[model samples]
Target: MASIQDEIKQTRPFPSPSAEAVVALMRTADMVRRSVASVVEPAGITPQQYNVLRILRGAGEAGLPTLEIAERMIEETPGITRLLDRLESKGLVTRVRCDKDRRRVWCRITTQGLELLRQLDAPLQKADEAALQALGNHDLEQLIELLDKARDVYRRIS
Candidate 1:
């Protein structure tokens, strides 16, 4: 079977994709996610679920609401509710209605939830280590710097 690079091959010179950066970022994110997801899913949680828990844990006792958690999230918001639901069912988190606003619901990472996250610390670290193992220290730092600059450029533009 012919590869995409081969399929796009031409005898004559052609304009290269300005979209290569976008493709690289996306593919890198996908690879990183797949590696992490395999480790996370076995513990009965998705990548996003782990993200929310981590954020809540970082926030400590003050905690955060569903919306706040959603806002801080790197992914979509609607998914947070579902992720919270699963975590709640697993006895990892707790949901409580606010006193000032009866209609509003708030989420707090329970002790159990924090412990579960603690349990994943080593494995997640390992996942990151394994993902970047191929790249040398200096190259990895350079790659991270480049990605951060890319985000900053987008922020300045829009």
Candidate 2:
């Protein structure tokens, strides 16, 4: 019988032969995303939405500007208006026009949002555990370090 690697096609041949690492990250991130999303989606929020709320929770009840929140996100979203729109519509989050500057909008996670996030906590933990269960602690740490290093590869280019 073929080994496990023989049955899967995760990486195609790369001209430079070094693109395998990129392929692995893409595949692993994709798998983790799906697994994580499954756990969080039932809470009525996408990963991005949850992330925004989490950031707000950490930053305190005062909230953060939309552009600032976008800067802190893992991936670049299409600005923050639509995201806030969806979250607000769900009553999970709220947007307030800054009194000092009418053009500045700050986003605050509502009590409902916090409650939903609280409900999602245990399940999210389980989902993360399930996703990383195959790896040993040392291996997981190494993988995390590698991904972080890769992310910082071209600070100037990005």
Candidate 3:
């Protein structure tokens, strides 16, 4: 495995280990994201769109409010409305105003969205597995734990 410094072609030493770790984590995340995108994009939806569809599918027939979907997203996006608009235009989702609360809009995955997700499911799983295949289960578990701990600290400070 190439060290982060070598991969990034950094001749000078990092000022701190934390900075190095942060960069490494970011680089790895981008790599994995691209890998996932390769499997998803050809199906006509970006990864973010796929994420929204997955969330709505999990929400079941009742669906959820638009704000709730935003809160549940893996990557915080400021243009969720635009994201929904694109999906809606593609016939993958539908949004309707709440009867009781006129201001609240509920979003749901359509049959097409669910079908797309179903088609991608196995391929996405395979892509994810391949991305982490170099790591054993124990290493993956430890990595997850460390990431969770780091995120917990971030949440507390943020």
Candidate 4:
């Protein structure tokens, strides 16, 4: 397998180690995301939809407000309204107005959505394992720690 530099066919060296690491991280992330998409696409849902379903499942019967769901998503999704619209049309989710606060809408996963998630549980596990297989258990743990630290630094800066 080619290194990220070789894969990208870059002739010049990166200006700094930080630049190279950033590019490599982004490329690796993109590849992993595409791999995940392949597993999800067959189920007739995008990865973002799968994420929403999983979040709703975690919320249980009480569900969660739409904005709360947006806040909990793995990535910041600006098109949440459109995403929810698609899920609602597919019968995967329902939007209900909060009783006490008529202005707030709660999003709940439908039976079909929960069933879909149950069906995906195994495949998603397999996909995640396969995606990270190159990294042994120790390496994976270390990578997680390093990534967490990087995120902490980002949070502090922001």
Best by TM-score: 3
Q: lDDT for every model? A: 0.86, 0.85, 0.94, 0.93
TM-score-superior candidate, 3 or 4: 3
List model 2 lDDT by residue over 1-158, tens digit each: 55666545435366354676778778988999999889888787899888888888887889998898998887788757898899999998889999999999988989998998889888889999899999999988998897778678866577
lDDT tens readout by residue for model 3, 33-152: 999999999999999999999999999999989989999999998899999999999999999999999999999999998999999999999999999999999999999999999999
Cα lDDT, model 3, residue 90: 100
TM-score of each: 0.82, 0.87, 0.92, 0.91
Using TM-score as the measure, name the better of candidate 1 and candidate 4.
4
Q: lDDT winner between 2 and 3, please give it.
A: 3
How many clashing residue pairs appear in each of the predictions shown?
0, 0, 0, 0
**Which should have the higher TM-score, number 2 or number 4?**
4
Q: Could you tell me which 10 consecutive residues in candidate 1 have the lowest summed lDDT?
A: 10-19
Best of the two (1, 2) by TM-score: 2
In Å, residue 151's CA in model 4 sits off its true spot by 0.5
What shift in Å separates residue 114 of candidate 1 from its native position after superposition?
Answer: 1.3
Give me the candidate number with maximum lDDT: 3
User: Candidate 4, overall lDDT?
Assistant: 0.93
